[model samples]
Target: MEKVSEKVRQIIQPGEHSYVFSKYLEPIAHVKPGEVVEIYTKDAFENRITSEKDLPSQILGDYLNPQTGPIYIDGAEPGDTLVVHIIDIEPDRDWAVSVMKESFGGLTSTDLTPMLQDPLPEKVWIYKIEDGMVRCNDQLNFPLRPFLGTIGTAPEVEALSALTPFNHGGNMDVPDTKPGNKVYLPVRTEGAFFFTGDAHAGQGDGELCGVALEISARVRLKFELIKNKEIKWPRIESDSEYMVVGSARPMEDAARIAYSELIKWMEEMGWDKFEAYQALTQIGKLHVGNMVDTYYSLVAKIDKKYTKLD
Candidate 1:
């Protein structure tokens, strides 16, 4: 969908140095249960990597994936759910950059994986955004499928990095989070402090590389609080389907968690015991979000039509 510029109830700007999602972080802005907001988020590297000569290894010391706003929503509390509607995602800059991380990706392990092998060389690719597409290169080109790579409500426990996806919805990198989609995040604290960043002009499933077509984006969103719904994981819904998102290590566990959550949610949707399982087995699709983060993410999706059985 083409980016739309409309009125928003509030506008939130990005903060510096603080990239993690935690309940302790103070709320930047507050909104009612149903409100639209325009948020400006920095690129994953906070717009530090502008040139190929600029080493992400050197520039990204700690300020990575800087998100905008832990926006407070009124009437939101623990055990409730925050429903985020993706109204629009517009690239703020004409250029975007992607990186091949030196030591931290699916290819090798650094602090997280802990291996003796040296990290890979940092490779940067700058793309020019034009004609409704981001030109990767002369040989490689694709449409501008921009979406937020990281979005989450603050976690109740310890502060978590914007690099990992958790129950509160951190860096899931799910490609399904585009315009017209609604992501239901479980509320962990009062007001549902939420943040978003890491916009990608284009990315494939299972973001095999650590980096995507990372770009700064002006994201338009609508928020609503689900008063009584208690969700165990992040759930997303589009015009046609419902998706359950789960993040974890070892990859398959993430997949398992997503499908399991889908089944559980389906049970609550008026399906008899095991009926949801039987139905999902025939109509579900597993979408790989990314495998290169601190935790891999998987999304289980089933078309809504399948759920309306006679």
Candidate 2:
């Protein structure tokens, strides 16, 4: 985590044409490791829907989740690991919104899950924010915990949509991707084309409605490089535990991948392989990051104290 003496903290914003995250895309900005940056990102709809008559399906034309950049971090290269420390995420506006399109969401009818009934109506929900909580209704209130819905590096593939989360990390929508959390992503391209977008003011575990409290935000973060770490999936480090993230079609397989990576990490910390597995089986906690994404994301977590090999 080398520090740079640049006088200003670079702030990046997505231009009108900035639409996707792909390895072929050129970097909009470059900063050395440990250089702090601020990002101003549009909501998933490009912040075009302002009234009740506006529909999410109609607004999301070719642009899916709008991203701020593929910022280049110098000295990062393939076979290394890129570490991102989320410094802060604050809602840019006073209100946030969520939507259910023609056939999206966990419980709604979709092309993937055919039903004999008509598709659900396009609905939208606006939550008023104050006192650090969103007022959904008299009985339902959600606390404000802002996070990025998509944070990923360009994969080795030519161009992958920002819809799926994989080794390079995309729209994982994990609430754990918050302030003070550390996310580890593999470096596939030189400088690790890291991109972020789709800020959510608050989200439930499954995102059952396919949308959270979508809001614009000022995201503050810093980057570092872990040379030669060679990790497979994205990992997260919180105050109390370490989490391995896996995203796949069947949630069971995603859970398997998360557990698999956690075990590998434990083994790397010098514990006996069998003992690590046994310890994890007894103490590991499984978390659902998002069940509404194209690929379900699961996280396996264990306390650092239990992972001490010495």
Candidate 3:
């Protein structure tokens, strides 16, 4: 609740963080639609693993992905669509961390994918961020592509952990939830308790090792509301593509949910359902969000040109 700027309507500090998304949590701040707010967030591990010497087994707590808010939008109600336009995301620190947990990640032996084999080694990699690049070491480096790993509205009755992603949009970890994109979330509860955190400097598809270049961030976002317009799943709009996200188990189910939702959206926009399905089969693109979370997330996307209706 520290006030950092007079220009920003609301400034939520890292102290105003939560581990779960629930309607029971008090609103940290309330804002009218169209207000620009700046939020400061901790990394996925809550900034616990600072160096390569810090291992997940020794430092991580019972919870991860500490979200920043349950910010109440003035007029948002059930069945409305909450639109969040990400204006910018700046890394608050010069370093980020990635880790490999013992019983986690895509290739490791997880509780969901049990195996007689031993667990993977618990290790951490600290990446240096300089000149807008994340340097893993002298041999590899990539441009920083910061995005929110967990961003969503609360569900009607469930108090879900920040680690899971589903219809309510927790921890989807989609790379598309970055700057210059508008994320549409379904509001199932009054006020649409919104929370976001788990900033990543960069992450590849599937979030391969179950971690990204986790970094603290200064995120600026604008909120808007679509009265009475209900969406079943999270949707994204970038400069040229329209995307829908679906989180489920057995990756293929996630893909089906994403594609099905996209087809339904196209139908609502006036395209015939069968034609839309056929068109999507030929031109749709699927991007893996995260294969490491409790549920895998897949994004179905199509370029704007193909979405233009006569």
Best TM-score among the predictions, by candidate number: 3
**RMSD (CA, angstroms), candidate 2:** 2.5
- Report the lDDT tens digits of candidate 2 across residue range 165-194: 776789898888888889999999888888
**What is each predicted model's overall lDDT from 0 to 1?**
0.85, 0.83, 0.91
Instruction: In candidate 1, list every pair of residues with a backbone clash.
Output: 44-65
Residue 272 miss distance in model 2 (angstroms): 1.6
Candidate 3 TM-score over all chains jointly? 0.96
Q: Where does the lowest 10-residue lDDT sum fall in candidate 1?
A: 1-10
lDDT of 1 by residue, 19-52 (tens): 8888787778888765667788888888889998
Off by over 4 Å in 3: 1-6, 13-16
Ranking by TM-score: 3, 1, 2
Indicate which candidate wins on lDDT: 3
Please write out the lDDT profile of model 3 over residues 1-310, one tens digit for every residue. Answer: 1222336764664354689989999988898887888888899998889988988988988889999988899999999999998988899999999998989999988988899999988888888999989998887588899999999999999899999999999999999999999999999999999999999998999999899889999998888999999999999999899899999989999999999999998888899999999989999999899999999999999998998998
- The per-prediction tally of clashing pairs is 1, 0, 0
The 10-residue segment of model 2 with minimum total lDDT is 1-10
Instruction: Compute the lDDT for candidate 1.
Output: 0.85
